[model samples]
Target: MNRKKLEALQGWSFISPALIVISIFVIGSIIFTIYISFHRVNLFTGYYEFIGLDNYKRLFNDTKVLIAFKNTLSFVAVVVPIQTFLAMVMASVLNAKIKGVKVFRIAYFLPTLTSSAALTMIFMFLFSLYGPINQIALQLNIINEPINFLNDAKVALKVIMSMNIWSTVPFFMVIYLAALQEVPEAIYEAARVDGATNVQQFFKITIPQLKPITTFVLLMGIIGTFQMFDQAYIFSNGSGGPENSTLTVALLSYRYAFGQNSTMGFAAAIALVLALLILVVSLIAQKLNKSDTLY
Candidate 1:
């Protein structure tokens, strides 16, 4: 073989393990999922029969599926911006040279490193009817009695949303803090010399420079919020309780596949729809980022 052919063979050998792993774990899984989505499968029967789009049709007409879609959208709409903005604010605060800055950063990031399951347990206790939160509210005469936060359809989902924000903000805050460190200090000094106040320098200089990081964080937040399974599952105890107010697309898909109903094919279709939704959202986010860069 020629020198070029030998080099090509060596390169392939180096990457072949990764390629094989991805083909089996990622590509193969996706193909298998798609195949399953076209078949009718039952729990008892343990047999799959090809049924071409029937699962898709069922998912379209399923009321719970519709509710799940709405809840997922609402969760993303509320959580993504709130989490991202709060992260930015936290990043700004920590980016400043202050006493024990390292400690503050570590404290802020502690929640992200801690167990989410444990956090959910603490939140559940705090949000319970007679929990400390409601006790304070009662002392303040905010309500006649302790309110059932997780049991009320109106407030259950919102409580979960709040939990999500608290748990996730730390993770994104670290990202923003890393990005903020990369921004040149000379630009801020120049702005300050031009009679710009702190707020003015932050809005005009810091924000514009952090645009790329903001875009990346926002995209990640959207994807994370859309695939929100842990918080929802923990908060609702896998039922997405209080009349399905907190039912997310991910939780709904799981229920369809293995919960009370064994509609594996329909669940697969839902999974595909969710994957497509994320893809479209990611594309749109990229386009918006591109547009922002032009200016």
Candidate 2:
């Protein structure tokens, strides 16, 4: 073989294993899921009856699906902005030349290292009726009575939101911290020379420079919050109870896919819808942020 052809063949051989694995697993699974979404699948009997768009149609008419979508959207809307803002603020604080800064950074990042399941359990305990949160509120006259955070429909989802924000902030904070290093000190120096205050510099210089990182953080937050399941599952014990306040679309899809009365076709449909929703929302967010431009 010619040297050019031989190099091309060698390069293909190097990538062939990964291509084969991806083709058989990732691509294969997606194709199978699309096929199953259009069928009535019976796993036990190995039966698949083509049902056309019936499964997709059922999603719109199902009240649980509606509730799930509402909850997921609320989660994404609230968590993404709050977490992104908090991450940026915390990153700025930690990036300063303050004493014991390393300790503070480690303390903040510890929660991110912990598993979501464990964090959920910890928050559940902390927010329990007589936990420290209630006790502190009671002592401070913030509440007349200890609130039942877990079982109360009004607060159940909010409690989960708080937990998610707390745990995720540290991760995105680290991202912002890394991005902060890339920001030119010369810009901040110029701002200071222009008699700009710290807050002014942060808003005008730091924030504008970190626009790309903020976009990344926002996208990650949106995707993560939309697909929230482990915390909700552990919080509601897989029932998404308390009037379905904590019922996320991901948890709902899991229920349909593996519950006692499994409906694989509907589960597949829900999963595909979620993937499309994420894609559209992400694209819109990217467009709005204009992450392609630095300024």
Best by lDDT: 2
State each model's C-alpha RMSD to the native: 1.9, 1.6
CA lDDT, candidate 2, residue 2: 100
Q: Residue 91 deviation, candidate 1, in Å?
A: 0.6
Candidate 2 lDDT over 1-295, as tens digits, reads: 9999999999999999999999999999999999999998867678899999999999999999999999999998898899999999999999888999999999999999999989999999999999999999999999999999999999999999999999999999999999898877788888889999989988988788888888888989999998999999999999996999999999999999889888999999999999999999899878977745444
TM-scores, all models, native as reference:
0.94, 0.95
What range of 10 consecutive residues in model 2 has the weakest lDDT sum? 286-295
Which lDDT tens digits does candidate 1 get at residues 1-295? 9999999999999999999999999999899889999998885778889999898888778999999999999988998899988998889889998889889988888888768788888999999988999999999999998899989999998988898899899998998888888888888888878999878876887778888888889899999988989888888889988999999999999988897659888888999999999999899879878856412
Off by over 4 Å in 2: 286-295
lDDT of each: 0.88, 0.93
- What C-alpha root-mean-square deviation, in Å, does candidate 1 show against the real structure? 1.9
- Model 2, TM vs. native: 0.95
